[model samples]
Target: MPLAVYILGLGIFTQGTSEFMLSGLLPNIAHDLGVSIPDAGLLISAFAIGMVFGAPLLAVATLSWPRRTALVTLQAVFIAAHVAGALAPGYGLLFATRVISALAYAGFWGVAVATAVALVPANAKGKAVAIVASGLTLATIVGVPAGTVLSQFAGWRAAFWAVAALTLLSLICSVLAISAGHGATEEPRTIRAELRAMARPQLWLSYALTAFTFGAVIVTFSYMASLLTDVTNLSEGWVPGLLALFGVGGLLGMSIGGKAAETYPIRTLVLGTGVLVAASVLLAVLAENTAVTIVLVFVLGFAGYITNPILQARVFGIAPGAPTLVGATNTSAFNVGNTLAPALGGIAISAGFGYASIAWVGAALGTVALFGALWAGHLQYRTLRTSSVVAKGTAQEEDRATTHA
Candidate 1:
């Protein structure tokens, strides 16, 4: 709603472009870097690895820093990493840059969500965070496909350079939009408090929900180019357009998700996970038809992301005592899924399951997440009913005491 929230989204857009651009550029990167396509996909996992480990560590490391300063500094590091990526001389160098860039990107995500939440009222946090997440959706819509086209024409290195420039601009926006005193928490939390918050079982359930939901999506998406070309028989030129279509669906999903997360968080997860499972199954069965494949890809994207805001908000809800750390840990859970999905997809591909098998992998993961979501919903309902009973009992006792007095 605020200008600052949109600016935070801008920062995520730049970082997200770098994160997902590789999906479209995998073949180009593989050829240029003299590695196998599967190996190039490893770059995606590498970036996720950096995010998985870097988020909480960086959140703790910057606990005392001004939030705005930390946000800008992370973007600066992101810009430098992209610059290095643009100039990388070999696969090793490029891979190193991917990890480094991801570390900064992960740190940015931790601080950015915390900042966005901090800037808003309790009722508005889901929307604020969703606004920030819209950047990633927008990246998929514009940035990723654009980067894919640039990589196709000018080479993958050029795409890296473009990302660097965008991030620089995002950094400037962050500096201008975020208020001067916006970074530090109103009541600074202790390290022990943050740690204890992480130990909650409900928080871990949220983590599992995050991991499985994202893993289901990534497994199918990581090898989408191969599915498009080798299976659907599409031309190289069509890849970016189809990817952009997927992004459009993601944008639609996110807009709906933000509002739904605030009003009906559990139902949102249930509906989203159900859609993902069904879509993945349809994609697997209908991969042979080009028209069907295209439609299902859009459905998959929409369903895959419909729970994004809810999952993020759910983690924060369960761990209110450690909002920043919980948010960062949730980011880690996302990347954990990102890291695992590609690896699993690669294994399926290596085993000669063909590109279509990726959809099955997604379906399986989505099913697991669906069960988790149902379990979580059950826990919430039980907790609410229990609390209601206790409150009613207390009220009756208070009334009796007042009458006697």
Candidate 2:
């Protein structure tokens, strides 16, 4: 892929690190700000809500801007927000900063995905997306752990400061790397045109599939620490290592799925979602077996992430005329799942289903996603068959006209 693609990935890495590192630092933040842990956890929901709204809104607002300019501007905003977060003296200020940072991050993500797809051939779109998304996987592997370690040694504020510094670097690199004219769409689309594209039923289906598939994984993952400690009876210290293992599985899944999606998008989705459902079921059934639970966690990551590129690529395919908006909406769809899964998992726990119940929730979501994928495949087949019939009739008409001539 283009160097700009990798640079965008690097940018994503910084933002993703900031987004996820809060999970590890919540306890420290709660204590420092004189809040309850649950209150501090709301910071995560604040970010997710920001992402859900910010993506589509910013995509339209910046629809006419140059890709590089938009990306750099968003990164600058992100850096400033992180700095504010690092320096904030109270919980309210920190929460506001998190919302602002997430807005910037979400906008950056939408633009980056569109830019990455614009930089590649149609056949290579999945791989390009995978390359960009690899940054998030890498963030889970390297950045989140580093932030946790930094928070442990230097305080939580230090982690925010580090993220701000890294974002500044990414902003500078983006300025130098992305060409001024390399916007995702050749011509800027009007908001009206993008809105019209959303009329397609298939596009909506794609978004639903994206949400369910991702939600399935996140339901279990959101409560993984509790499951490990309470159900599997592991030490809290093992949490980071296990999370890293999941990240490793995610990276591998992305690599495999990216290559396969270009040729077999439906099959890739089906297999990935199917495996995810199976893994969740297995995890739920075997939670008490420490080794089995550990192995299933890796499988969960792998199965969950393998469908990501396909989910991303299919939206672009379905809505070729509205790349930016489609990208933004897809980003929103992801956060929708991120936002909902935790609530559902919490409800299940509150209902006395326990930590393992989250896995059952995941399995249920994955099964829905799996059926959605199969339905999409059927629709694709019908569309192709109709197109083929039309083409054949046109060819026959042309042949008859030629004979008359």
Best by TM-score: 2
lDDT, candidate 2, 1-405, per-residue tens: 789999999999999998889899999999999999999999999999999999998898888988888899999999999989999999999999999998999999999999999988999999999988889999999999999999999999999999999989998888888866555236756889988877899999999999999999988988999999999999999999999999999999999989987999999999999999999999999999999988998999999999998898889999988989999999999999999988999999999989999999999999999999999999999999999999999999999999999
- How does each model score on TM-score? 0.95, 0.98
lDDT of 2: 0.92
The models' CA-based lDDT, in order, is 0.88, 0.92
lDDT of 1 by residue, 146-263 (tens): 8977987998889999999999999888888887655443566677888987888989999999999999998887788789999899997787788778888888888889888889
lDDT value, candidate 1, whole model = 0.88
lDDT for residue 164 in candidate 2, whole number 0-100: 92
Identify the leading candidate in terms of lDDT: 2
In terms of TM-score, how similar is model 2 to the real structure? Answer: 0.98
Report each candidate's C-alpha RMSD, comma-separated, in the order given.
1.8, 1.2
